[model samples]
Target: MDSTKCQDHEPSTKLLNPEGPTATIRPIDFTRSPLADDYSSFFAMTIDNLLTPDECARLQAAAGDNWQTLSKGNAFRECQNILVFSPEWASALYDRIVGHLPEEVKALRKGDRLAEIVVGPSHLKASVGARKTVWRIKEANDRLSFLRYQPGHHFKPHCDALYARPGKDERSFLTCQIYLNDAPLSADGKSDGGETRFWTSQVGKRQKPPAMECEPAEEKEAPFLDIKPKMGRALVFQQRMLWHSGQEVKRGEKFTVRLDLMFERHFEKLQPNS
Candidate 1:
């Protein structure tokens, strides 16, 4: 990442999934913010301002209008409703961040230590076998899931499902959650509650990662991390071994888009559920 090279116009590259045109201009000062720390790259990282505040506002407006197609209303995928959409900007956004990503995240690693830690123990390996390797990032997933969390909406810890199709050279390996607004806090400013928290599960554990019925107050022991939900920040992480949940919203409305990063899988004849 050379920060100096950023300019008015950027080289254009084609998108994979839908074969669309690439982004011609950089949206924001992506260079001003770098990865928070080294460990941020291991499983998850909080990327600052991937979407400009204006862009986030526009997307939120769109989500509000198209609420009928919402997904998830259960305890596991709890939320007001997930508004799904496939906007034209999806490709452009993916284009700008592709270069900023570290080489390790740009490619899928079936043997990645992190992936093995979660997948091997969970029933996920039955579907996400180690045989399929990473070819390269294909494009942003076609669908963008916009989730609005109100007063008490939340989700329990669980690993995201793998959408893999090795025969077609398609697989989803990473998730890029774009925060549209800052999560609110209490009047006393003590708890910044609506955060997405991560937890670690050993590789030998059973398929179902620890699913708590409610926030464990006694387990007030800090989690692996509570990723910052700063407005316009994008928290990107690998799908494998990442057990996370959306903590209950304490104050105002919290908005986020759950977007997946599609990857071209190395050809393997025995690929499972895709």
Candidate 2:
């Protein structure tokens, strides 16, 4: 046998599971879990606001300022977000702000330009820390966004990790999901598919082009924790660790606002945690 051309071939050296070593599920109380701990579960907190029917209607009407409905009337999906800087609410919040610079920050318009408007001190202060909170803002950051699920509509099993960019380099530290409306319960006194399911593992993270078929067996039966969406409540979680998806809507609607926080200045500048 020729040494150059007939040399024995080496065995292929590749492990089937890429994350076989450093993957796990750490359990902790969903109600009072610390931010530093890594958790792969869904959690939510009901806010302490009690708005009377009249007040609810007024807020709904005046909500046009920063409020954006997901779909038009009659549509199955409807949601809103960041009313802190909407034009209709702008003037009111402006009056609430000290010195009220109306000329400098007039209308609360959508996009990157509305950052100059400041709503109020209480609104700003409420957003501090990892607590489930909201703030009235003159403008929303680029990463902040909202979503809604209408009657009969559903967001199937999916993961926040899907939002993670390529190269295994960058990831968002926090994902804030807030529920603005509560779905009414049925005759049995149980709400429909308003639960948020967070999967611990078995998601197909294999490299493939977008829209490619995912590994079915691994995703369909993953261990999961379900969280019901309540009005004025919010959930904060580590984006990459949790694979979450919305449950099917059996009766009333579901609305949620999402804020994805990127630690680096821009998406491109993200680096793995040191």
> Top model by lDDT, which number?
1
Estimate, for each residue in 1-274, the C-alpha lDDT of model 2 and write its tens digit: 1011112212111201112122122223543433213241332222222222233234333323343444333432333343222232223212222122223232222221222112212212322233322222232123334454655665544344323345532334345565657765789987777787765433345453212222222446555667677654445444433445666677876655455433221112112330
Q: Tens-digit lDDT track for model 1 on 109-217?
A: 4555644432233322333444554446778875667777777777766667666655675667678888889878778877657888765443344534332122222
Q: Which 10-residue window in model 1 sums to the lowest lDDT? A: 1-10
Query: Of the candidates shown, which would achieve the greatest TM-score relative to the real structure?
Result: 1
TM-score of each: 0.67, 0.45
Runs in model 1 deviating more than 4 A are 1-41, 68-74, 109-133, 165-167, 202-222, 267-274
- Provide the overall lDDT of each model, using Cα atoms, as 2-decimal numbers: 0.57, 0.39
Off by over 4 Å in 2: 1-144, 161-171, 203-221, 265-274
Compared with the true structure, model 1 gives a TM-score of 0.67
Report the CA-based lDDT of candidate 2 relative to the real structure. Answer: 0.39
Residue pairs clashing, model 1: 164-274
TM accuracy, model 2: 0.45
